[model samples]
Target: MATTGESTDTAARTGEQYLAGLSVGEREIWLKGEKVTSPLDSPELRSAALSMARVFDLQHEHADEMLAPSPDDGRLVNVTHLIPRSREDLERRRRAIELTAALSGGMMGRTPDYLNVTFACFSGRSDVWARRGNEEGAANIVAYQKLMRDGDLSTTHALMNPQVDRTKPEAEQMMGEVSLHKVGENDDSIILRGARMLATLAPFADDLLVYPGSDIRPQDGRYALAFAIPIATPGLRFICRDSFSKQRNTFDYPLSSRFDEMDCVVIFDDVEVPRERLFLDGDTVGYSEVITDTGWRGHIMHQAFTRAYVKLAFAFGLGHMIAEVTAVNRFDHVQEKIGQIWNMMELTRAAIVAAEAGSFEDAGGVWYPDERPFVALRGEMPKWIPRANELLQLIGGGGFMATPSKADIEGPLGPEIEKYFQSAGADATRRIRLFRLAWDYLGSDLGGRGELYERFYLSDSYRMTALAYTIADKAFPASLVEQFLED
Candidate 1:
């Protein structure tokens, strides 16, 4: 728990400081079938960690835009942790988020800024926690927020319980299927046992936050818990999915090699959660309210929308580059497909602008991005992202499939490749590099994962659209529609 001194020189962490914290943690992370001794020793995991470190370095480089003076300690912290009291504050936070997304080309979904703002949202409305008679929880939130801001901790969250028999009540779900649950409570701590899924970026995160998803029911009190723990906590093990970045040459798997934020299933076997770490426990109402009443949904989605927009922009740029190399930029149909992607990118950008314009302060005086634009963006993204990939693949054709490997270009067959593989104006190596990037985004295993990630990252399309409809109904009530019908 290092504190930032009040001196102006004490500001947000540098890339070196962030990496040092990650390098020494004793985390139990499994990849494939074996235990990973040190995450930094693994090429894929280390690359991802380095990618995140770049984000911290960017904050230091653009301190005025990304860092702001903390009210608690006059030292500057990342703008994402600032509790917004006005629209101007919200705009500053938005700029910080957008800049982070651009730095990662929007591929890094769980950038540290997202959760920093989430905790900020909780601290912004501590009274909501107090209403549930958990003043200690409220205090802990404020303290945790300051700790994160001062230490510049990176976090990943596991909110969705393991997918089991969804039709069954959460209480009826199989033993390990329902995620970390309260087994016993002592004076100082509560013991938990179970597992949580889709802990994205778990290997790179310094800490983990376990919270209830949108599906928690009233009867699921024992399962309805929210807390944070160090990633190295005893008895907490992370079983990772296959690493897409493993052993692939960087030239072949550009995106995956650098930006594979490994997803994991976190199993907590009798993990002890100290009272101070518990934000909500056994209270289903409080668990739900922590999300709904705290204004987290709008704020978190604002970050997501910004990231998705940047990701799409990257896809569009990739497509444009490919068209130029392939000499298809002149073809009408190719131009039409590029236009489609451009339109999607512009719409996503517009949604962010519109949401900010409609930003409003809640009763607690915390400014929140307008929910309507987010709902619309979330609803359309599932289709738009997949389509963007498909267009890239369609335009790219066999170029994506037939590109020479990095080894081949430098091997004995180099002359043959140079002669036949060269494009209109580009040489063999340049053409292959551009197509390889396209493959990474559209044709590789990493590309497939990106599609699936975007499709469900925000949740299912049906639910998202329903949420949009719900917001529209509230904005334009049926009573108002009745007047038009009667006239």
Candidate 2:
């Protein structure tokens, strides 16, 4: 507990300061074969970085909405730190998710604090976990939570291991093969090697949080390790691929206008992490069971809802645009399409809200979202939302497909374009601009990938549901099972 000005030191730290401090790693990053002095300076990464900093600034600018005081230490903390002691706590946590999601415009926007709470809720009652908890695991959870509360830093997760060799025995997973293993310890730190893909915010985070995913095989303990390292630590390089924004020329691209930031493949080339930051090491079986079932599903489901909300917002607005442009706004079919979009939106919201409301209390006076509704919703919604996007897309039609460049308006073809393609009542010029806005998502990066993402998301959630079932053995009543078998 540092004093108020410094009290929690975590409390007063704003998004701007965090972005300023990120310069330490900028010198190490290279984009397009050139080094950058401030990673935040690049247009592609800058949007995401600014988005990150905006979150911090938001804490100050919208303190009541973005933060809450943690009861554990009376420290003013981001709502990401909230542990639902009751349904109200759970609702507050969901609202926090909503606020941040809205702020990031639902673009890959969770801060490090998101994972911090998972570690908190379970770790706070490490004793129940210890009910049978290995003392070491208990200690590990507590230590991790402390660092979390201190706002020690931002971190990204490496959950999806790169699929390198499917033909090999599950025992020998060797895709480019960058997994953590104990090489030898320096006097003060542990060294890690091997690389992991899709660290969602790794490119600009202070630390990288590597933990075992359910996909990890127990024999592959080397890959089961969990820990963190500074973004510029020796031997760690963010061998990130080309930016998604780089995939296009800026003039016609819309999703690239302000989205697609902070995701990259982080390659750890035998990097060393200070001991204090290490939470779990070489305990794959333990890490898998703990992570996959312990509490991840709840947080993960909550995190995805942010995207759902964003997509819904797009649909509502896009639906109306579609109806108006097609001269069918007053038509029953068009109105029905619009209604379907709203129904899907409300459905997703209900799932998220219900999951939070039904959360059960835990022993430490803390509460956690119950898995049944969440798991059910997680399994069902991803499958449902793509249809909404599909409806939005179908209604959009050729207007969605023939998106013209923004520069076209200023070029020689401008006058000819205005003469032919305008919507019913609007001028050709106005229609082009409106269609372009629709094209941004309906035809461009956000739209093209959105429905696919929903399908992928639904498919992924389906797998997670199976994993939960496998872990909990279908939440079966074993005593009754044996009795039935005997009879």
Candidate 3:
């Protein structure tokens, strides 16, 4: 309903205006062999851009209800920009992520300010080191939060160190594998070298949220740094990878037609980080606490669980549509399959409920799930959800894979597909439509992408769901352990 003025400078841009506002250089992409100057024109990049732009649009169109107040500036901040000030606030933030996931069918279309909120909380709470008369880190925190509020910016985080020879010390092992330590003084700024492990749309973000996830001894102070930088800062080039939406067939597959997330490996080649932007530099204790903090874990847990919950909703919706077209709703086995779907949905829902209901710690206005329970759920999903999808496969039989391609439906072969693909009262035309819908979830590359998206989130999708029980729990009664051991 609300319109964005293309040239008008306001809190944010409209979906269209936001795209228009981006510097052309920011979007110049090299994928595979071709040079793509405008990612918006490239099929692979369009979906991701569209999805992100939608967030800005929401800020303008739904400003009164969905947006939150900025404490730093007292202005309205979009859901992504709103700081999480309580446990309930964290849940609300998680719900917002879920809404976007459902809109994009869990394809990883990110909402900005995601990592910023967590770090903002960190800036306020963490102060393990002192540099100047003023603990500059804490002061930078306030400034950055205000910066985020003023710019109405979005940020992307790169934390996980890439896999390397674990036998080596982290100082050596994580060197080339992730955002490594760079040179600089405790002066006006710091200079960073090396690169990050996994970059996610950093090229397009307004700023970068870089921090270490590993435990750090005081000796590892060089690696225990936290900082933010504008994407266009000198020497900060985000070397992106080839888009996964590589399929050449653009007319047929809609899901693959546009990927929702464009994750890149950001290359910080001798990048300069201004001092004010540096939240934690050369402070290992502070850096470790910020990450291992319940604030960080709670935000991530809530985001992952909510994303999964929405994913199940999308999966089961397609499953129901498939059953209807085939008229298998009458079959007892089909009914059982539907019941199975409901169960998977419940699993995700229960985890969310347990998290909110069992919230253990509250800080910076955000509530974190108990480490034990959250970790348990984190380690449990991969094993169980796959089996659920397999059951959907069993009931649908070859129906999932048997679906005709969208191209066939529109081409001369369309008639044949329509006649044969239709199920029960529906003709091949109707059935193929349903089948194509199902294909997006269970058959095509999109389906695989969905699974890939989830696989990327859970600790290990191949591991047992029961592994959750091990990591959770603060204290164990020795008597109970002794009785079990003796028995």
Candidate 4:
């Protein structure tokens, strides 16, 4: 293991440094109708914040695996920020991603590394932002990438405009005016007002990123914008959903207590983004091309799909454990249920390997994973994850509810509990602990949110599937069919 400060000549910030950064406390993060003055003091927010800090520390402790030298300077950076130029570099990044994912059993989706990878892609394809009179935007991207890399900043992004009404065009809706759109600009800064949703990990992050969440219609050009700003910027506020981290008992609400990354709707009240920070400005066509043309799609999906694989593998392991403890591994039906989860987990793993093996250099000389595999994986995950949860529920059955609380196991009922709760494979205490964990993972609010996040994380899975079909190369397959018919 590397010494505390020796991870690199310029050390990645430690867990303590990460926590201290959050303590400066200018960011407006509201939870349960009150502004969180100190994230470390809030019972609901502290564990998740600490969880992120731990990952930051992990970067230091496992620096050999996660940290790399910055291209511009010798300062060590996270592999997520490393601009991959070869398959070897990509494989190195994959290992780091796997380590981070395995840390939380892939429960924390918006780990800082997620955006670390994002900014890396932005830097890798800075030229894409240089067209159509936006040379400054390209420069801002590369500069910002280095800024965050050197700081080892934890960042979250709010991409989706609030879902107020789907039937009407955004400009036509009553609440549409409040959706995040550029209102005006001064010489040094662009002013924005309105709101964006699903900013996961907003409170804990050092910065918040805003970009086009969907297609920008030509008429909605005023809404086409992208920028990164401090989460504490004046006129910025994060209104969070009620926390799933309310339960503090690590044993009773294991997953919820530790990994409840909060989601929020970010309201911007004429927030000013300085010229140097704005990456896209009211250019609808350019905004639409950023992800696909700049290598962000493939890179982001590479990180996301790695997490998906880890999450599925975690689910499978949890299911297997439940079966083993209850001795349900003996039954054919139970075995079949277990096999279903295994199948999905294996497929996800296979996709990651396939994508990496077929990695290619884009037109800009940046290497990208074969995004094709993850496109399929992303669409199928929504279906597979929910069903995996169901199988775990089926395997555990009423045992999830029958388990005793942590207090009950330790109180006057201890003797009676031990007598009754023991399984063939585990003692009563062990049995109760396992069931409580399963409940926390499958039945709690966090569990429900996890399911929803997977469904919509990369936008609607249904649309993703349609997009895969639309963009796929059908010519070769069609030609083969025609050849057979002619023969």
Give the C-alpha lDDT of model 2.
0.63
Superposed on all Cα atoms, the candidates' RMSDs to the truth, in angstroms, are 2.5, 4.4, 4.7, 2.3
Task: Encode model 4's per-residue lDDT on 13-83: one tens digit a residue.
Answer: 88999899997758888988899866787888999999998998998888889887766656777888878
Error of 4 at 480 (Å): 2.8
Report clash pairs, candidate 2: 2-7, 3-7, 130-133, 164-175, 178-194, 178-195, 179-194
**Model 4 lDDT, full chain set:** 0.86
lDDT of 3: 0.62
Candidate 1: tens digits of C-alpha lDDT, residues 1-487: 1256665655588888888888675889999777775678787588888888899899988887888777876788898988888778878888888899887678788889989988899889888876667888878888888888888889999887778876776678775346667898999999998887789988888899876577577777888888889998889899998888746677877787888888999898899999998888877888878777889888888888888888889989988989988899889999899888999999988888888899888988899888787888888999998999999987888888778788898899999999999888598888898888878876677778888988998789888898777657563576787778984
The 10-residue segment with the lowest total lDDT in model 3: 1-10
Query: Which ten contiguous residues of candidate 2 have the minimum total lDDT?
Result: 1-10
Residue runs of model 1 more than 4 Å from their true location after superposition: 1-6, 175-178, 474-481, 484-487
Q: Model 4 Cα displacement at 64 (Å)?
A: 1.0
- TM-score, per-candidate, Cα-based: 0.95, 0.83, 0.83, 0.97
Tens-digit lDDT track for model 3 on 162-221? 557655544777453353676666567788876666667664566677766667667766
Q: Pick the candidate with the highest lDDT.
A: 4
